[model samples]
Target: MENNQPIISVDHVSMRFNLSKEKHESLKEYFLALAKGRLQFDEFYALRDVSLKVMPGDFYGLIGLNGSGKSTLLKVISGVYKPSSGTCRVGGTIAPLIELGAGFDMDLTARENIYLNGTVLGFTPKYIDSKFEEIVEFSELRDFLDVPLKNYSSGMVARIAFAIATITKPDILIADEILSVGDFLFQQKCEARMQRLMSGGTTVLLVSHSIEQIERMCNKVAWIEKGRVKMDGPAAEVCAAYKQTTK
Candidate 1:
């Protein structure tokens, strides 16, 4: 299922956030700070000038410490956030499982939430209708589908979200630390589902701190630190280098 085609190309992309220290202060004070050339503002560069490529069917791993910009990179690729500089070209359909239940309505029933989530992912009502039963079955929430989402446990919500995400059969899938959800048995099922997607030619970008999971799941890895890529190559080698540095 490995296509020898490039699916994503990121060229010298950088993302920055400008932190204004005088948001609550008066305009005169802010102008005075600027006039004095001592403005108390900071620039937080979440992702420095970084470039990378992902090919179709590639299981790409993004390994980094918290605040190292791994999640930022994923968000950029998924079009949730735009880069401040440089260009990112993504081919094919993309599905991001970044924050589970991000768009769910707490007051809506599970079934209603499914439709809402599916619509956000670009599925038509007919398409959602076709996959409704399958999604509920996969999540093992058939009985709870009629219950309000507010009544569901966090684990239950995550399960439904995961099921809805994978049902789209997207060409590009970006998952950020989603594997930490659910019980042990459910985690196994999710892993199996991911394997199925990979084998079916879906390009996956996985961001995780778990070295073992990265080694087991990804064919290529990129290690990031302080918003920069420290190492990029075969999964085992990159992971090894990361471990040595962290230790």
Candidate 2:
């Protein structure tokens, strides 16, 4: 990162969900139980008192075991979930590749969905028209443009999603397991694109399981264990420590 000012800041952030203990047969039954004061619940905290900061132009990686709240934390950053307590703040626009096929319409053709998903991501129709070919070129799915997205493989879907998300180079790019869906060669392509963005002063926050990838790409890292930050530092130090514990 080039600047001392944090482009993204998380302060004592905590996300909590109240899961109902009782399962009702129907909507009426659920309402009846609620009316009778018979409802019970348990609190599940996906993130607790977690704090971190990302500087401008940073390639920050988040590493953790599955179900360790890595995705949840990304959701919080993406504004998909509001924290039960604390705050998450970002200084600039965010392009989030937080889920596979998130902004796509499965029944629609890949061509139709480019316009659909593109508008949803805040691009104007004229703007999309101008950049449509570039998006297709990067995805390398020109032949499949007329095909329904439902027929596409996961890796194929990933290609389109990533190409669209990275088209304009927003102030911050947030990714969650995006590289894992693609084949090795495709993964390298994505990394190269990210490096290009980073060199142009874009900030990146990524969540990935590949330790080697994290070590190679990220200058900074945070190790989350059981919904809390277990360690945060330079990638080499954090990844090495995390590897030892897992071993």
Candidate 3:
């Protein structure tokens, strides 16, 4: 039974990006246009007056058509993007698997980047050392440990990234289409790991296009359409309504 307490709160959040209308061929030309005050920008709002709450231990899903601000909302919640208006707050540490290899150094060896990324996520050196082997094993890249990450395949990169992010339990887990990049088997493995984390009271916020997956894994769903929430409630109801519109 979830109380009224919210672990993740997004209140009237709005995100805006300024896009330049003209692209200058060189830096010199760009500066000249800027000096003349001739550059023009179009303001685009990715999210508009969006609000949401996830209580402790809730399995939340975000579903929408592409460019419907699903990923933008997740980025805002993860602190990667500051909301143009309103606010987003999280109660605890977050493990965000939003973009593949976003925290990794491509030029560095997998082993080196593991420690680097782990530390960035707030794990102490001693804690990372304890989970070092487990990370390598889960990614199944034992022989490639010393190899530079740039040489790794996309799937290989996804493996290492997912492995490192889930190595230690987190208070909140945010994933954005991360499972789509991996093979089916690896996706299944990820789902199993997420289940275990949820059982331990880790709140999950997931973005996936698969309605079937959402209904199966999430207790609640929010349908975002054209930068606003069109529906929010029990997963079955929201997902069923969303599916109807798409059909």
Best-fitting candidate, scored by TM-score? 2
Q: Per-residue CA lDDT of candidate 2, range 18-118, in tens?
A: 87777787999899999999887788888999999999988999999998899999889888899999999989889999889988999999999999988
Name every residue pair that clashes in candidate 1. none
Global local distance difference test of model 3: 0.93
Q: What do the candidate models score in CA lDDT, each in turn?
A: 0.90, 0.93, 0.93
Pairs that collide in candidate 2 are none
How does model 1 fare in lDDT? 0.90
lDDT string for model 1 (73-98, tens) is 99999898899999999998988889
| Rank by TM-score (best first) | 2, 3, 1
Q: What's the count of clashing pairs in each model shown?
A: 0, 0, 0
Q: Model 2: which ten-residue window has the lowest total lDDT?
A: 16-25
For model 1 the local lDDT of residue 104 reads 95
- For each candidate in turn, the TM-score is 0.92, 0.96, 0.94
